[model samples]
Target: MFEPEKQLVGEWVLDVRPEEVRVLVSGFQSWSEAELRPLTDLQAVPMMKWRHEQGHDPAFLPSGEAGVWRSHTLLALVRPDGSGWVGCAVDAAHTFTHWEARVDGQQVRVTCTSEGPAVEVAWQDTADVIGTLETLSAQLGRNMNAITPTPLRVWCSWYSYYRDVTLENMLDNARLARQHSLPFDVFQLDDGFQADLGDWFEPSSHFGGHASELPAQLDALGFTPGIWLAPFLASPTSKLFRDHSDWMLRGEDGQPLPVGNNWGGPYYTLDTTHPEVLNWLRELSATVRGWGYTYLKLDFLYGAALPGVRHDPSIGRAQAYRNAMQALRDGAPDAFILACGAPLAGSIGLVDAMRTGPDVAPYWDEESRRVWLGDATGPSARNALHTALSRWYQHSWYQPDPDVAIVRRELSLLNHHERGSIAGMLDIIGGLRASSDPISMLDEEGLALLHRCLQISTPDRPTTLAQSFGGAVTHFSRGTFNLTNQSVTNLPAHAYLEQRL
Candidate 1:
């Protein structure tokens, strides 16, 4: 059995619940200026707070060298064999503004800012990390007992167009979605459609300022038009930032803080506590809904919830996030909320589909080949799929979206083996499936694979992870259907199914 311990330092108390999980608690700071020398979780390094505030899951190794790093909210502890439990400071804000998790060899620690009743934690010892999160899911008001998720086959505009998506290209894909024989529920537009980051109502010249009508046009063609929005973010050049800098979350120096660097951006976070900002979000989201867009992919969302000096200091980042997400829910009550770049603990009851991994890039490995902890929150298909596995327990909270499952062969630089791997991984793991490929362009073989991947997990039978070698090779057998990122060419069909899920 794993042992649990607690330490009291400077009015801060680090306690491992039930005394069964062997954990160490301490304050944490992210290594911000990390150079070509990539640091995993174990190494003692100075970490910056801004890097992982929002974006893919921030994977950490662990450490306990105090003075080098300050305390931050959130920590995990496990036995040497990885059979312990993990927890986050769910609503523990009144006591401490900072919390962190650290791992030193087999020891783990969780430290808070000052230690108060505001911290409520989730704990479980299932040996499966997924099970630990599953326990946390319930405490966050997302009881798996109440949710019924549908497997989705989505067609997104990002992987194919990047930020260069135009009205013409999106319309063609919508048109193809209708005529294509494949089964698809949502025809979604990604980043390129927005006029700016937080400014949603205004569309660029490419959209002809007519994005409000695009959703209806797609719906008319037999698809649920899905729209993407970074509800909490605004680019520095955008109208939202220019007109309402005062309404954004700011630093101690009285300047709006940049949450994370993405899309060649120093994106700004909106202060959800400000009534004006919330009102604006409510109106814009409703307008999108009025235009017939039912699926909302909220990206770059960590900004709104990043631990920062906000307009309302009384409200914690969790509540700030809840406030903003509540507005989206209130604004578009009927829409499907696909939350990406979000804090996993606080997002429990809000979103219908949670992006469990990083942005699945077209290629497998780039600068950081080993799925660095920093890159875990950055963009990488390999990391995306890999993180998806580590977060499988989240499927019980919301339909886990493993990002885009790319199947196209011609335009993509990914080899045939790599293409099948992404598609297969998502098919087996993700509750929501989306292909960021132009359906009209995909050849027959690609189209066939897309069709085959659509069989979803039923309410009575959810997919399970049978075996994995850190995502390099994964095998999952859901009922009679056998699946693996390793191509069928590599593993025999019988052996694939014979393995349990």
Candidate 2:
């Protein structure tokens, strides 16, 4: 509970509990004090008797079970002038968590630690009190739904040649996404779209010189047009590299520095410190915007800084992202930028979305194949839960994408039980992205599974039951319940959950 010593104009109470927390603000007529629930709760499957002990717990338990006995913390704010606004923050050090909440007379500016792993809630005079709160609730609720272990939004990325799929095939894929009632907002055309990686202009054979038309068609089909571009990257073979070699980040020997691992030859990083680089990026952004792309997934952003580079380390990683982000904003003012392979801290107040995990491969066998692969194993799942738990609070206009949904795959690749386990985990992460090819390939049962994953809402209660190297399980419950692990060899993991009926 928070009770300020000063004779403040208004009083705010912040209640933190093991399962959930609520914030009540008095003296404000617009928004009655409301309870903000954890988004991770929605992902918990039925379970009874779930609790965390100091030891002897299952190695990899769900969040609800793991976080039960964890210590929690809360921070609250008050407005002295009777302005009906307050600032609030909450964190659980056990999880290295932080979150920010803005209570405007009506709306609340709420960003959870689980969303960005950091919280920034401040009162802006020009803010919309009611709207902000509504948005906060909606965003938080979306995360809750994600954890509900149900799929809400079904999306796919257009990596063009990377996936060995074509533009026409992508259009067909869009139709299939809508067929499943999934709103495909981003039809991302990855690196292969441009004639050369550096020449941010001209379409390739894969796109058939109809890059602009592709997204427009997708929009007509009710999908948002999304394109992929590493604003800071330039292939040595690119025309831009030939013309602006000076703009590239140079090594100690004055040679262009290389960044990514998958790509064969060397690529240069943009010297964001140079005004020319910023100007060129802005023009490129405008060009992409002119091409009718509304969503931009900025990749390879971490390349901006290298270990022994001649860059300003004083401003730090966060500022470097800010510089690039500002350039992006100037380039496409209305574009939605989703940060990928970039540090989460640097993306605050800049990007509209972020990839919480690494790239997920289409294969189901190799652990290191995809970005979310680490999340598939018990230990990786625990790490993912902790990551999601730490960042949930930061979700707002900027959504935290835990990475792609790997549920639907060729039957030969994964079995039903394996699929169920993956499905259950996807619910925990919340936001999802799928490849273009798989969207069209899903069968009836597969589509149904995907839909079920989308519908689960965020849990009303947020708690961690147990965490271990094998895996961690968290639970969110609104009533008396019990959860047990049935991971006996050759048997499905089962949980028995009961409610007061």
Count of backbone collisions in candidate 1: 24
TM-score of each: 0.77, 0.60
All models, RMSD in angstroms? 7.2, 13.3
Instruction: Name the lDDT value of residue 229 in candidate 1.
Output: 84
lDDT of 1 by residue, 356-449 (tens): 6667776765545233432334555555655564444456667878777777776766665566656666655658878878877788888787
> What TM-score does candidate 2 get on C-alpha atoms?
0.60
Give the whole-model CA lDDT for all candidates, comma-separated.
0.58, 0.46
lDDT of 2 by residue, 141-171 (tens): 3432322212224354432236344577667
- Where does model 2 exceed 4 Å of error? 1-154, 158-163, 311-317, 364-397, 431-437, 459-462, 469-501
